[model samples]
Target: MVTSGRTRAVKLDSIAAGAVDLAREAAEETAGVLGVGEYLGAYAEAERVVSHHFACPHPGYRGWHWSVTLVRASRARVATVDEVVLLPGDDALTAQEWVPWADRVEPGDVGPGMLMPSPDNDPRLEPGYTGGESAADPEPAEASVIRAVVSELGLGRERVLTVEGRDEAAERWLAGPGGPDNQLSKAAPATCITCGFFVRLRGGLGREFGVCANAYSPSDAQVVSIDHGCGAHSSVPEPERAKELPPPVWDTIAWDETGGLFD
Candidate 1:
């Protein structure tokens, strides 16, 4: 406990002072009996209650303060202890409340007897059509134009890809490696838009992004921006193969053993 030289004095009423003294005595007695050490010099008084703080003497228990609160009745000269409690100091080692393992589980924390439930309103999922039992059944007559567009584009029956979805995909691709400022795109001769293997996507997205079908290209089978390109452009000609050399002729002449050559 520390007090500054310029500390303001708290003018406590006589009743409050008596309560504080009673709280200190009670705290001392409790600490002596429990062998928990003695109370500090500093004490707190509020209304009719006074708190006397004690130091925790137990090993491995640091930054813990024990306190005894004493309260006085109306017009009463004497005060009685309300309760004794252990509280955390400015720097205390405290443990969080005990939680069952089940309550502490995260997304990937899987184990036996653990049940994870899907949320009712997940953004990735849409409610199934309740008109027919079979999923293969054709859509009802009241289906909207958006549903027709989805079916025509082979997008899927459950959810229709909207303009917003296309914009989001374009934004992601523009910010990724396929963007105009990327190293591969900057050094290329021509953009994917001019490449013969560039397959334009369906709908509005085709204007900005397309699939590269050039097997030799780095972006093959992958979505690329209109202005993005690699070294393997479709217009680049293949190098010619070198011609093979003719086989060498062999001599059939025989040599005589007398140091003279015989043909």
Candidate 2:
């Protein structure tokens, strides 16, 4: 994992991967401070009460309940706080009951709704039978889902960094004397809804990324990626506000391979 003080410039994708690892730790730290133990105990009680009230039905019909954990995608860490609730019904959720958690959860937390089977459920090599699901079609990749989530929330995919770099800032702010509060430090947490977790990723003038503050609430889930950029995106920042830079030096490097998701 990349720490605060490395001199080398990390690629966005590489930094994203590293962010997942670091954010998880930060989330766990946050949870510990937020009193996860008390929350979990209450959550267990709620589960029992809810279960007793409505007997679980068969398979998909059952009233399934879940314990919620906050996850920070940047650091790929789960939050320490627990958000236990009875799975929501088809009707819209009450704001009083859920609005407070807007700071930590996101729609992507639910993951892909359900597994969709392909042509057949067979697992073989040839003729009529074929392998069940291809390796390429796994449940969901966090990277792709995150992109969708950002779109849905109207957050930016890019955060601008200082021309210098994060390490120099970290040394002055975090490592030197006064940590984080230093003017150069730009760290913010991104909370997912479906998962109910909050993780902090690095941000600032050097690294250009998006901010999707509108996505903090559960109601924001109704806003799909395709529908973003509409009037509803009032809280999203305009792209013109970001610090501009020349194209990455790497863009001109001879490409041995295409790192893009699609050919």
Candidate 3:
């Protein structure tokens, strides 16, 4: 038993060291490859992830660039290094060396409008945007649109709005525009088109925001973000939570008649 315990401790130590090593390597790589502007942009994206995950005041980093390293050196012998170059302000590390937004959406931000399938870029995003959008796609229209899609198609018996509102929103959009007449081709085209929400619920893609089971990948709708309950916002939601997401700003996308989603 004691021998086993020592072995475990040794393994743990290796993993911890590996994590540090991975972070350091990524930081170096980031510094080497990116210019100031590019690094700042990457940092901004990383900051969002960090802020959302930590939910604390910025802790500050030693340099403008930072990276996340995950090393499983013992059992699986796996090592992962994520490089993130931050701008000149705000640090996001905890005393425990944790960056909360590492895997979550930034606390109070929307999607980033980037393309997908390039290099960890979210595939679900439309071709117009630049960076990977955030993971949360909360919108009021999501509820109605998703419901309409599902009701129209008669796909699964799953009910919308059980626990979290996100699920319902996702389901409804997956159903598509026709309500029930148009059969969802291979994947939910209209609903699955957006990338941020895709990662929020469905798993990540090996190449882009690959195949989502969500009904229709709806095109990006314009969602407004005005101060609710403010003087000029009387036209906003009565219940506050029921406010619709700003309509998508991009042009309306046509229904995919070709059958395949990405096609």
Candidate 4:
């Protein structure tokens, strides 16, 4: 958030010294026993408004303090308590700044039956040639003719992916399991670019990515990079075939050299 760019001066009231005990009593009462600790300091907000700080003794509220604001009416020497509340200190343990559910959502967080609405001004998408989904009625004859011409040129979509969106998708695909860096690709027989089941994607992504049409591939039906591969590559090597020969004749004719049957 942007700063105010202006500063205001505060006048310290001498009466703050007289009301220190009163502010402490207010803070103690608001915090009850075991909440408030030793006195810290006091500061002035206006002519007769002052606030006193006391360390918070609760273990869960580390680096937090009790702030008791005191106010005085005209000609009154004694100040009465206005408000008492707990405030964080400079080095306090605090939670991260809150983020909207839409902004914090990650990929796959929206499952089936979930609808995550996209903001109209999202940077990832830009208006098509027709300027996308206007609530106004159809335009004049000349404008309709122009729109028809644009539609004939294949620009009929309401919104198109911006350069940032394209780049984001490309990077995500390249880092996923179907990318060249994954274990399957590292030990693959060959890359998908030369595989028979590799179906090249169209448009700007055609040169770098394709769909895996191989049923046996782990990444089947998924987008894979040009260099990504698996054992199911079309031209995997075949095992060596065993050789065959004619059956050999028995050496019965030479068996007489061995003599007796027992032998």
Candidate 5:
């Protein structure tokens, strides 16, 4: 036996010498009780109590081990088995490490009753507006004065209507189906700007977008760009209805007999 800093350490050799045979016999008895195959041998170790290792017999469970622990009573000469457990050996099959439920979430897995809270420091949105006190507000007193004057003159906020915004909107319109690139617009005789059914909007946007009032047009009642066109332009003439030709005058009667009668 070996002695450590504060407590006595039971020597592994001594435990193996004493418990190995006992553990093998116990393992045999357990195998019989469990209706399993016999264990090969008992391998002993000295912990607080002595533990014995035995190889498992089940063919499906490779590299798994069965362990039986033995503890000594205060005055006892021999150690008695504390418990038996099935444990995993170094090469035994086992489940993966457990993961948190939140970490396992995937896209589209959120359903009703699932509430995902946004992070406090979201990058997409700005903090609430605090008038001039907001750090995001522009500096320059002249700039603020110009904005105020524009608002007083009935011009909307820069966010609502800006030259840059108008340019972007114009680009989008020019690239969309309502633009001159469309097949209908390509064949149209005139653009929407000159169409009688085109009702212009109010504000700066009015210069570009207008409502199509032609009931028979594909874009009827829809907002179209000023340059947009369609086959149903108001200036296009209606097709003339075909007139019925006069029935052929059949000179039925005796035109030939009349020649002889007149003679």
Candidate 6:
């Protein structure tokens, strides 16, 4: 009813304007006396039409308003009731607007057997032959040869990760549990790259990332940044081991037997 901001207020129709009693009657008929409380105000929607608002006194609908729209024909002196409805006020508690299931899903929300299909034009992926491999046209001899080799090895996928996708993955791994920032990495004696248990990955990410092969490490079998580390690093000192030694023998009696020079 109360207009503010950049909303241009429309003039109240003469006949439909002051029909407070008529609006109240409509609201009472739709929602009863308990539903229609004190009158709020009138809203001029457009020419020859207006809406009356009333405090909603219904039990379940808190902070709602009863709206009764009235309209008058041209040159008509009387207003006719148009419709009655309940609308939420600014502070009303209402359910959130519905969203599609696809839009509502988050990471890890898709369990086993649930499919989340990616669009064909998704920016994260592109044809393997034309993606990270090379952008050269197949018409060129070298490019055609490369494509053939790629297909023969079953490496020519329908789609491969785009540069943006690779970047996103790198960022996620760098900020994950196997990154250099965690408490375990901070306390590690040596980094993954310096350990013999670290297996370097292939391709562009290989230079700064790899999989941790150390079973004792927290990052076992997981992708880790080069600088990420753990206490189980291969370079850590080994535990002390038992040493072999000759048995000792008594010498006092033997010395007396061998030192008798006078005898």
Best by lDDT: 6
Rate residue 239 of model 5 by lDDT.
98
Model 2 Cα displacement at 237 (Å)? 45
lDDT tens readout by residue for model 5, 1-263: 87667966555545434676777666667765433345545444554367777787776667777677777665567778777777788899988999977577775688999887544443433333223333235687766775576556665322243456567767776687766678888789999999999999877778888889999999888778888899889899989999998666885653563456558
lDDT of 4: 0.84
Per-residue CA lDDT of model 1 for 9-108, tens digit only, reads 5444455544556666666666664445666743546666667677777665677777877677778877778887777888888888999765787745
Error of 6 at 55 (Å): 2.2
lDDT of 2 by residue, 197-221 (tens): 2122334411321222446433232
Candidate number achieving the greatest TM-score relative to the actual structure? 6
Ranking by TM-score: 6, 4, 1, 5, 3, 2
Model 4 worst lDDT window (10 residues): 131-140
List the lowest-lDDT window of 10 residues for candidate 5: 127-136
Report lDDT (CA) for all predictions. Answer: 0.71, 0.33, 0.33, 0.84, 0.70, 0.86
The C-alpha stretches of model 4 lying farther than 4 A from their native spots are 1-14, 32-34, 45-48, 72-75, 126-158, 181-187, 241-263
- TM, every model: 0.50, 0.12, 0.17, 0.67, 0.36, 0.73
Clashes counted in candidate 1 amount to: 0
Q: Write the per-residue lDDT of candidate 6 for residues 1-263, one digit (tens) a residue.
A: 98767966688986787888999989999996556899999998888899999998777888999999999998888999999999999889999999998689887798989889988898889876532445247566777877777766557677888999899989999999978999989999989989999999988888889998888877899999999999999988999999886555855444443657686
Cα shift from native, residue 120, model 6 (Å): 1.1
**Candidates ranked by lDDT:** 6, 4, 1, 5, 3, 2
TM-score for candidate 1, please give it: 0.50
Clash-forming residue pairs, model 1: none
Stretches of candidate 2 off by over 4 Å are 1-147, 151-159, 179-263
| Candidate 3 C-alpha error for residue 32, in Å | 2.0
Per-candidate RMSD, Å: 8.9, 36.1, 29.8, 7.6, 14.2, 8.9
